[model samples]
Target chain A: MRGVVMYTAGDVRVEERDDPKIVEPTDAIVKLTATCICGSDLWPYRGIEPADHQVMGHEYVGVVEEVGSEVKNVKVGDFVVGSFVISDNTCEICQAGFQSKCVHAEFVAQTIGTQAEKARIPHADGTLVATPGQPEPELIPSLLAASDVLGTGWYAAVAADAGPGKTVAVVGDGAVGLMAVLAAKQLGAERIIAMSRHPERQKLARYYGATDIVEERGEEGVAKIKELTGGLGAHSVVEAVGTQESFMQAVGATRGGGHLGYVGVNYDVKIPGIELFFAGIHTLGGPAPVRRFLPDLIQLIWDRKIDPGKVFDLTLPLEQAPEGYKAMDERRATKVILTF
Target chain B: MRGVVMYTAGDVRVEERDDPKIVEPTDAIVKLTATCICGSDLWPYRGIEPADHQVMGHEYVGVVEEVGSEVKNVKVGDFVVGSFVISDNTCEICQAGFQSKCVHAEFVAQTIGTQAEKARIPHADGTLVATPGQPEPELIPSLLAASDVLGTGWYAAVAADAGPGKTVAVVGDGAVGLMAVLAAKQLGAERIIAMSRHPERQKLARYYGATDIVEERGEEGVAKIKELTGGLGAHSVVEAVGTQESFMQAVGATRGGGHLGYVGVNYDVKIPGIELFFAGIHTLGGPAPVRRFLPDLIQLIWDRKIDPGKVFDLTLPLEQAPEGYKAMDERRATKVILTF
Candidate 1:
């Protein structure tokens, strides 16, 4: 089987690797139908995080090729969408919607990277949600989006309490941020402000339901959000960028008593306690419990109710995984879907 | 008029000061019936916060002596309980139940120290809640408690989402922490764990409805809470002490997807971003919007439903305000109520 692996920073390759197989009774082998590179992958790729011969990719929509004896819900030939953080949804934390912290959870990239011809999924019944059937070829990207980014963006929107009569401010222009605009709109937010400097991303943001765009960054961006929100700030702020500046901007752009749902994987950031306390913002974020929403999101994709797959501006063959990573890392593509 | 003044750190004096007069159309002058030293007061008193001939004291219950032309809800001769933070409830933030950050909000001590013969209260119609009548002499201590500590404790419990079927862990044993146990019980918390080592405070905690008492601190305290919650931390945690250790303990003692309502006046505390991000806790706290809950708290106090005032273990005359501060500073008393 061919799989994507990073031997070191700035070194990504697609090479022949041993095919994944069911090692546990609760595991299943999925024949990868679609997979994609994530913004988070850039962390290790840029040497910001430690990396040594690590298998890459966590987002995927695939067809189950084999199921262990204990697997009851999913069967071979079933099309499914799974979260980046595979969680045994039976844990108390998972039941409470913190599936990312599930007691029996594993990171896909660390165990069986989804960017391969076949991957082993643990806690098969608890982690994988089967779609209605094999989705249309065009719907593949949308289903794959549900595996991570779209679900994460939805979680950010929900955490921010975006809903009818509320104004939502998104703090990043990446796929997640643009998707958050769509989520906020779907949740009935009256106004969606996307803070993006890039014209290309800004166009996509507007297409995804952003009512306003602030080209400024940092304090200026917060000021624009406040100016648009009657100087009170947006009622809900989705922080899609993990940097301290973006987090602070999201916090600053939210009104007092408003919610800040941050999904940006924070890296080397220190949130000022005093500032956050005085800000009077209700904050809930972290690695999203993507599994909790995967079922609904899959249905939405199958029903063609949402086209989050549009985020994938480039597509490549599975053997071209390195190119996929390069495109996303270099900002040449918002997302790159790799066909197996 | 006479008032308590902190001319310098560790130096408190009862001195002659100008009697407060109506300063705004919505202001009222109140003749203080009672006032007390707060834990937060110790900050400035201990020289942690700046103090220079600053009028002290924010907690108070008093009789309205004069009302401005626009004051409609409060009248002269009416007994009232007011929050430490005065706010006009008509503001959007105030209406959202965060009166502490209201556009017209003013800190009581900064504007007109409540520990005085007469003090002017801004936003009289919104900041002051009138009692049924002149509070009986015996109710003064309790009514004064309602002015700050009790309300703050109640806010902590509410913010932590303490209610039926929930286990609540309190991370501070001060007056507010003890009062928080009472609030949790009244809010229908099934189990209340008071983290206290002081024998006297422990007794008071149990008296106020603490079902369990953990004598440990820090990691041990978190372990004890986890043991009590079947290897999971408490569903709700009340952080009444704003220190790095206490804050971390509160965070550690709360289960994933739990609420942490922190009311401690944070000072020089740096919360690690990674810890908070991975903890999966819902956190909300600040200078509590006590005014939002004052009416109900006052009604409960009036009906003798809960005796939060019992926290005042010592009493002193107005002239002995210095002694009250000393007693609290020395931990010789849980709280000291000064009477005129």
Candidate 2:
């Protein structure tokens, strides 16, 4: 088996590694059909987050090759999608729709990298959801998307309460931000604004149901959103970019008593209490509980109601994982799907 | 008219000041029946907030003496309880139930000090909620409580979603925190945990429906809450102390997907983004949209359904305003009511 590993910052390698086997009675061995590099991957790759011989990739979709004795929900020879964070799913937290904080939760990226031929999935019954049937080859990309990015964007929109009669503004042009535009639209938002400076990304944003596009960043971006919403800012604002400036801009772009859902894993950012105090908005965010929305999102994708696969502008073979990382890190690709 | 004025950190004096006059078409002149010292008033009294012979107090229950042409909801001779912040109520923000952030909002404490014999309330129709009729002597303190502390606490409980089947933890021993306990109980919370070290406050907390009292502070307090909640933390947490520790404690005490409502006016506090991000909870806070809850609060007080006035442990005449301030500043009184 071959897997992607990073020995140091800015260094990615795809080399032969031990084939993963079922480690727990509830675990299943999955032969990954497809996986991808994430914007979060850039954090470690760009040295913003540490990468010391770390396994790479959390987003994946695959066929179950083998299952342990305790795995009931999913069995061998079934196509499935799983959340980035493994959970028991039956815990009080997961039952409350916060599977990401499941009592037995584990970050799959740090333990079982999916950018490989095969990987062991713990708590398989709770973490993996099988499609209605084995999805067609054409539906693979969108199914893989339900693993993280799309699910994260959906969580952001839901957390922001983006629905009918509301204006939603997404602050980030990344894959997650673009997917948030689609989520807000699907949730019946009356208007969607995508904040992006790049012409290409802006075009993609429009394709994802963004009714307006603002190129400005920070204060100017917030002002633009406020101006478009009759000086009240948007009714719902999504923060998908994990930066100090982007976080504050998202906060400022929400109307008073509005909802601000931030999904960006901000690092080293200190939220000024005074500003947030005066803003007086409702806020909810974190590593999204993707498992909560997977079943529905998979249905939308399977029904072809949404074309989320278009987010993958670049694709590469599994062995070329390094180039995929480089392409995404250099901003030459919005998202790069890796083939098996 | 005589009013309470703060000449410096420890210097308070009742001095004769010009009588308030209606300035805006939306203004109304009210003869104050009662006023009280607030926890926030201590900020300037302690010099944490600057005060230069500044008029003090924002809470009031009074008789309307005069009204400008546009004041329709409130009229002369009407007994009223008004919010600390003046709002036009009909504005988009106010209509959204965030009157504290109304576009034309102004802090009454900063502009029109109710500690005076009379106050010129701006946006009278919006800020002042006329009681059903003239209140009996006993209901005066409770009606005044609705002006800020009681209303603020109610907003906190509402914001935190303290309702049936939820565990609510209040992280402050102030009047507002105690009121939050009462509000949580009224909201049908399954359990109410009031964090307090003072024995007297604990007794008051029990009277307000706190099922459990935790004497611990900081990490110990959070630990006690988690232990009581089966290691998952509370479903709703209210932060009524405006300090970095209290803010973080409230965040720590909320379970993933839980709600945190904060109302303490923090002077120098910075929220650590990483901690808040990973906490994955919902938070809403600020000066509180007291006007949004004033009517219901007034009704609750009117019907004697809630005894919020019990929070005022001391009383002083208008000329003894200096002693009232000193008592609160010295922690000798939970709250001090001023009479004519």
C-alpha RMSD values across all candidates: 1.3, 1.0
* lDDT by residue (tens digit), candidate 1, B160-247: 9999999999999999999899999999999999999999999999999999999999999998999999887999999998888899
Worst 10 residues of 1 chain A by lDDT: A264-273
Please report the interface RMSD of model 1 to 1 decimal: 1.8
**What tens-digit string does per-residue lDDT give for candidate 2 at A20-127?**
987799999999999999898888898988999999889999999999998999989999999999999999999999999888889999989999988899999989
* CAPRI-style grade of the A/B interface in model 2: medium
Q: Over the stretch A235-281, how does candidate 1's per-residue lDDT look in tens digits?
A: 99999988888888988998888999988646578777778877877
Q: What is the DockQ of candidate 1?
A: 0.62
Q: Output the number of the TM-score-best candidate.
A: 2
Candidate 1: regions farther than 4 A off: none
The candidate that wins on lDDT is: 2
lDDT for model 1: 0.89
Residue B84 alpha-carbon offset, candidate 2, angstroms:
0.5
The C-alpha TM-scores of every prediction are: 0.98, 0.99
Q: For model 1, state the Cα shift of residue A301 in Å.
A: 1.4
